[model samples]
Target chain A: MTSWMKKCLVVAASAAMTVGMTAIASADDVTLEFQQWWGVELPDGALQEIVDGFTQESGVAIELLSNPYADTKTQVAAGAATGTMADVVGLDGSWVYDFAKQEAIANLSELMEADGYDDSQLSDQIKYEGSTYMIPVVNFAYPLYVNLDILEEAGVEEIPTTWTEFMDACAKISENTDYAAYCIPLNTEAPNGIQNQFSSWLWASGGSLLKDGKPGLTDNELLANLVDYFKEMKENGYLSDGVEAMHEQDMVNEFENGRLAFMVDGISHLTTIKKESPDLNFTYAPMPKADDYDGKSGLDVACWGIGIAENCEHKEEAMAFIEYMMSPEVNAKLSQLANAFPGNSTAEPDYSENDELFLKAFEIFQDGYAINEFTGAPTAEDLMRSMNEQLILYFDGDTASVDDMLAATQEAWEAAYN
Target chain B: MNAKLKKKLTPYGYLLPTIILMMILLVIPIVMVIDYSLYDNVIANKNPVFVGLSNYAAVLKDSAFWTAVGHTLFFVIVSIAAHMIIGMVFALILNTRYLSTRTKGIFRAIYALPWMFTASVIAITWRMLLDPNGVLNYFILLFHLSPEKVTFLASRDIALQSVTLINIWSGYPFYMISILAGLQGISPDLYEAAALDGADAVHSFTGVTIPQLRPILISLIMLDFVWTLQQFALIWMTTGGGPVNATETVSTWIYKQGFTKFQYSMASTGAVILLIVCTIIGIFYVRHQKAEE
Candidate 1:
């Protein structure tokens, strides 16, 4: 080899060694991983931007593991089995109890106190059995959507606030227009889709799927009334003929195409509908109550929360990262970026100032009618899932009767919980 | 070590990697599943309490398990029959000497197109084509055949058949290629001999061709049976064991139990049952092969 070439090689090798040693020396003392299921969040790259900002402030590099919400729990379970779980996992607020029961996640009571996290500032959905297991991250409410053009064309001057009037309006809408009135979720494809939508009707009817930690399927008269109402709607052509196989996305498409008059969807869908159908005139309304039931009720709101895994090595560092993410300024920025509600009480979204459907949705959401029924009944996940599977059968006219569905569901629920 | 001992161990050394891989991938998972099936292991429960054969007993007694089995069997039987019939016809058509080499190659590629696509992609395509207002319904209406719309996948009585048809479409290509290979192996001299004996085409096909293809058919049928039993993605992507579990197969049901319901022990019990069923069929296939020999 040439002498100058050899000398250049030696110089390059020494420079590489110095750079490697510097990186090793400057490595953070504790590196935490954050696993979340918001890969499809609005304002793409906002999550990574927020994480970068957090890293800059805390100097504790956080690795973000993103997945879809449907597969997040399964991934977490597999990770737990292999002892490679992420330090912080973003979970559905409804699943806090399930994870707590398994002891898969750590109790964050001490960390919250140490970080001066006021529980009152967060939503009630993150608490389980008088203990805080997760800190609320994002909140969403499912409200009814009404096509104003369809209502005006149908001569429906007033929006229905009771089940009787609601059914009457549906019949009138069908009579006036060629489109159906409502897209009942006879086949939501996903259990959560049906569970979240059904809970609204169940709550509006002054009933719940569970009572005192037991199955309330057969015991609740309002549930029977709810089933009868569903049957009546189907029998009267108020629902689509293909309702037996319609999923949430299909329903949204139908609504956008002017084939349906109403649907129950997340407030985040407001942005999607506006973008997809720029000229469509649609408005949001609170879920209606039953005629006999004079109580306020709304759909169960689904929210996201961050929890510390039980096997997390850097609990203090993880809590610090979470504290940075939940700071009022950062939280508000995230809410604005993602078009989501603020997770902290002190950081309210400015949607109320806008003269749009979102403002009405925000009003209805905070009007005290919408309760976090998912948290109200810790066992609602299993109970409602079982009901969703069996009740769809009844709705398809496969089962003998609503009575049979009630009996079978109550039996299955007893077997499951017992 | 002695030369004889070293020689004996040499073959095993060559196989050592594969043996270890099988033990890790196959044996360990089977053992874990069997162990899990004997315990009450909900995903939320930190510790699994031993329940002995109660999980198996529960599975045996559950009516839903039987319904899933029945649906799975119906799908398998119908799909396999359609695959064999259509595959044999296409194989025969391609095996004909009258066809040019380029034409044969084109036909083969056309037949193999479905196999090139993933099951999910095929399922989504079929879903769109079979939707209530989908292309098929559009054609049906254009012809003014039926005054009412045909709900192929939404109807309880028709969803299973719809999914079965899709499975048949996705699976028939494998059988066609196998049968075509078997046909190509049969000597042309045999057909000449049969012609000399005044044996017609039908007699030759039934006697010579059928007998020569027996072994290949047996092996392919057994493999097809097992594959159909474990089919998941297509049906899951399409019906999701819904329209009231009318299309619920054992595999989809197992997935629902484990992932959706978090009933790990129950799902494991179902998996063990599937394993036993497959093992029994495999043993019978081996015995049948021996009997044929």
Candidate 2:
């Protein structure tokens, strides 16, 4: 061969080799998108720190997409519909059934088995049709928040433990104080109030809205009594005014401003309360139960659940990210930062440096079993909205009777489930 | 290849990109939505079965759907009527020769402030203002207007009217701006002639101004009627059709059915019904515009 030809061939060979090496390097540098609502809820930069830790431990990079809770749900749903969901999505338990049934989310059990992940370490996995779809990373329990100053000013001697005592306390508080005795946000705009606040009363008294995984609101006596309790509160002017328009944040704002005596709210609000109103004397305790019931109370819970999109390209890296987040140490830190309970059974968040209210809330959480019937239910938000509408009508004195309201709700829920 | 054919096809060539975009952005999605309405459990189901017009029948049969229809009619009718009156008043004020230009400019800006804020911002601001413990209530108490606080957006009796008022506030600016432009275009000689004919100010207004602005008024009413009928974000962010479906418009109902309830077929049915209604109004608007041209 001629010298010129040999030189040109040698340069082409070198270029090909360089291109191949670059391609290999880029193949290992995968960037997964993690979409979630936890970023705003947690301490600033906390979720980013968690993602950074995962990236550092593994070479897989993460792109964090954070939005408010409702916005995130809508975006994720839109993405799911369009087959463009993020690689790692923060799921709500209520969304699990629909997502799993649609095959929008990956089968987490298969992913765990494929990765040889210890599934036993998880305290809760949102499952549908015998397969897990979501792993809860942190749990927030809904307990009753009491304003001690309001109680004191109202001349209430002790915290109420039974329905009767609770009513008495509400009466005294309404009679003696300028503040309302209690507030339950029944706003249909974000109607999870029916789940977190209203249905919690029934759950606290060891009642179930589901019988054998179906709509069980037809003849549930506990539910009827719970409705009656709320009606009584309304009739006696014990409930805070304008509940029809109040949202969860509104209730928290009232409590923080000391205009409310009691509210059944998420324990995660403890941090917000302390930050917003440092002087507000408040404490978290278990929700009041029925006087005749002596069973284990079921505390309502919400969680920051994590799942992998079925359309994700890099399943291995996504599974690794999930494993990293669910590891005991990481889960504990996340729970602590979020002021919630760890989703890992063995992950005990260190509360030594945390607020005392959190510690007390943790104890209460451990004392009661975590339950939210709306979780993993079919069209959960619809159920909440239906019940919320019925209750609103009942409160407006537009419905015939409590039985009629419950019957209407039962019909609506059954229609949705079917 | 002929000159006549080339000239004819050239216009189509010029319009090809827009036609393609309309097909992709508007037509295809509408067709898909209609198709979805003919099926059961669309996006959430792996294999959806075609259910004919069963979904539409179900939506029509729902009491809540009828309630929403009633509320939507009330909302749209009230909003359009109020917007027209308010817009006319403001436009007249701004167009008045009695006022200085600087004063008119300031009043115009002040009146247009509500339109500057987005639906979400307006919803949040009004929510705070209408809360029982809100500033309005505080003022009411300070003046002893009532013994108790008024739940403006919370009461069943008044939530619909409250949202309607808010809609009017946010929407009147468009009508005002349009009517002002139309008013400016009217020939002053017409009013002078009316005055020479022994007409008073009121007579000049009704005889000259109203006739001159009739086309603009018709167009504004039609456009605002469609827009107000589909008002979702304000009502969604405000009451969410709450206080027991007092303000449940068709748009909010469709949103709940689709996004919240995961019933795509039902939502699409409701949307199709709304589309039909709007299409009817659109036909009228097109005919009116054509006749004016």
Candidate with maximal lDDT: 2
Please give the CA lDDT of all the candidate structures. 0.79, 0.91
Residue range A243-271, candidate 1, lDDT tens digits = 66666777788888777888888776677
Q: In angstroms, what RMSD does candidate 1 have relative to the true structure?
A: 4.8
Writing each residue's lDDT as its tens digit, candidate 2 over A209-263 gives 9888889987888898888889889988898889998889998999999999999
Local error of candidate 1 at residue B228 (angstroms): 0.7
CAPRI-style grade of the A/B interface in model 1: acceptable
Off by over 4 Å in 2: A1-26, B1-13
| Model 1 per-residue lDDT tens digits across residues B171-273 | 9999999999999999999989999999999999998999999998888888889899999989887877777787989998898777656687999999999
Report the alpha-carbon TM-score of model 2 versus the true structure: 0.95
Clashing pairs in 1: none
Question: Candidate 1: deviation at residue A161, Å?
Answer: 2.8
lDDT of 1: 0.79
Chain A of candidate 1: what's the TM-score? 0.86
Query: Relative to the unseen true structure, what is the C-alpha lDDT of residue A261 in candidate 2, on a scale of 0 to 100?
Result: 95
For candidate 2 chain A, which ten residues in a row score worst on lDDT? A392-401
